[model samples]
Target: MENPFGAQTDSESGSAKSYALMTARGPQNCIESLHHPRPRAATRAGRSGVQSDYGSSKNLETKTPNSCPRKPTRFLTALSWQYPNEGVIKINTDGCRKGEDGHITARGVLRDSSGQWMRGFAVNLGIGQVLEVELWGIYLGLKIAWDIGCSSAVVLESDSATAVHLLNKNVEHFHPLATMLWGCQDYINKNWVCSIHHVYRECNMVADKVAELSSCLELGLSTFQDPSDSIRSFLSEGLLGVCRP
Candidate 1:
């Protein structure tokens, strides 16, 4: 077959061919690819110095390219539970709050340089914000450590970075929990080798489990000298293996 506008076409053949000749554009005879045949008006626009409203001929090579979406890179950290230095006891604390009507519970577990659970405490804060519970956990953890002769050195760890920042005097804010902050600050000031840091929640599993258990108790504080079967499992899981990405 042939186009009436000085171009040829072969549609019934195994491959199709289409062409256009424009005398105004210096005998420009644009040939369309077998897959994409250019419309006659678009070919005429080329002669009138009009850019192709459609993409260029090169873009018609493939309607869709053969490319796979990239997968996101995975970041892995070998961070796991670690013991404190000699004469220093590491205290891991966590807090849990369920809902507006639920109770706020804070729990802390103290471990020696040998990773021995020296003492653990769980306080039922009745109902409070998560941040307040975390701060209370710190205050109680430090006080218990002091009472139990962990005074040589203390390394407090919490999952909540906000609470750790406040405890370490990294930032200051005035809230109802300011009293607990004052207590933590006073203890840190008096202790010569006291330090607080933020640890991944996986490394603080024992404290997290204890905190969840505190919410089940009947609105009171409880202390554990010998960890229960559940708490023991959480501590073992945290210390036994490296976290995989």
Candidate 2:
């Protein structure tokens, strides 16, 4: 099957397809954009056949609003109201820009099958790079483990292989953000010693979009100053929107 993270420039799935990764500075590069396809509407057009009208509430018993005063909850930062994370309770984490210069803030979300969200965090990082954002995703997952007092978690994923590999095997931290990353690494090392797996971008939809959405908003949200606010507020405000799985 073709990679969900990318699209085939030539219409054929196997025809010299390209995968695109967003740049820390701004929009994604054309080649990077080619790699991952946006979530689709229900039907073949979505291509994945994973589309549903989550907004439809035929009968909830509670008087439905005559008209949606705001967005129809189609999918804000998540891109889709229906996500792949089910009962598994996968924690999706992402990073975005921080200040005026567009410094990236690392954000994450935790959700279960019933669409219940447990937690979320948005950390503003001084370093602006995809690798760092990916690392932040991993760190946030580990932090969630510590929060829930879990000894180990099975579904730790990241879009960036560089960071995941670094965690898998100790490596030098060349970036300036290593200081911040170390805190997250320490949480995993001290709390959940092992069982961290590296997953592809396709599996990390929630976090990927969380990071993307954080970048889109001008919330001035950061974990460095007030972790509780960053993590807690992110969960309430961000997760309550259009979450998946």
Candidate 3:
């Protein structure tokens, strides 16, 4: 099958495209084949520049392509998960949808300032859009943080840029995932400090692996007080500041 994440595949030879790996010293052109499954299509909020409930509203109605500023050029950078500030907790969340059966799942991991795992959760959301599933992961992560009495503050990180952008902008009331967005807003509006950010997929491997685990487990939500054996290596890499391409 063709790679879903837009990696060019050789039909005749069955070889995948190679990506350049970057390191602290410099860019090392290592030929390594990687395959990424295709994700669901984005909703209306992702297609247009609308204001989100969490941030200041922007008048996109009067804006045109020429009026909008050009996006910054993105460079290849090594990424690693960073520890949160003192007295703050960091939550990394990711959503995964299997290309074979379209099974959607969301997972989150909460770590302390010292990079110790506090709590984690995985939910099998059955069938849903990618944005909705990503939001569900954020909502559940915040709920878990609140339930554990995270009094200081919390920083949530997601690999899906669309999901992060949607949270910062206003979703239309008629959007299919409007209610789901509202649920996430309720957690953000609580009397506590919580911020959401977009991280590269490399920095979110732990949550990504956890989300993929839902394929074998029972449907519903599962919480973990201790790090599972499968994800312990990834968690250790985060603490060691290991960078990935």
Candidate 4:
């Protein structure tokens, strides 16, 4: 068989050659064993005319040749739940825990139509498991929904599937986050217009970043009056493209 792209014509050859290029995926550090594949490095001549970090092909190749630079995977994250938007209010929640100092925190942020910030808040959860923290974040967000009077909410999404599962299950008793279920149930009982979903960290980008910020004491914690700058990353990644009506 002959390859039309090239002059190779070996019909009787025992082995075949493959030139399809494969790019990396997932987090920046997810790929291992593969060598540090950089893009083709800058030729001295190519670098001479470039004024910006990535103004030319050689400059880009020089910077990240082997890097799998896909767009931020928040769409991949949001798509996991198969959630749809139709005249519904959506909420995203996130939680975090530290291993060394036994510290934990949860932050929940909400928004409505018109790109307006509806609510943002953080709680010093003291010492708790990561799942408990995630559940707390979801619970807190639901409480906010009630306070703000959001009607007919469709999805309550979290980056942690384990926590989300615990949230929408038939638990015999409350974990560290049992009280949150009580609150969530109470809110649903009154409104009965909401549902739960498990969005991937990529989709729940804003919440994950906000939850990670719990460990950054230098950033200083704030309440609904002041959400940590984590949500900015989510918006920049374009997660709200399918936001509800």
The number of the candidate with the highest TM-score is 3
Residue-level lDDT tens digits of model 2 in 83-192: 33343445555555555665666666666544455555554444456665666556556665465654543244455555654554333345344443444445545633
lDDT of 3 at 114: 96
Question: What's the true lDDT of residue 225 in model 2?
Answer: 16
TM-score of 1: 0.66
Candidate 1 vs 2: which has more TM-score: 1
**Highest lDDT, which number?**
3
Tens-digit lDDT string for candidate 4 (1-245): 22111222222222101101111221112112223222221112311110111101111122333366763332211232122455556677788777886677777667654434555655555555677667657656776676566765545667676765554444444244444444454444454456666655555655666666565431112345433344554554443353221
As a whole number from 0 to 100, the lDDT of residue 162 in candidate 3 is: 75
Model 3 Cα shift for residue 169 (angstroms):
2.1
Clashing pairs in 4: 1-11, 38-65, 39-65, 77-203
TM per prediction: 0.66, 0.45, 0.69, 0.56
Candidate 3 segments whose C-alpha is farther than 4 A from its true place: 1-76
Better of 2 and 3 by lDDT: 3
Worst 10 residues of 1 by lDDT: 48-57
Per-residue error for 162 in candidate 4, Å, reads: 2.0
lDDT of 4 at 93: 78
Off by over 4 Å in 2: 1-89, 97-102, 112-115, 152-154, 173-178, 191-194, 216-245
RMSD of 3: 16.9
Q: Candidate 3, residues 32-87: lDDT per residue as tens digits?
A: 11111222222233221212222111222333355556744344456677877898
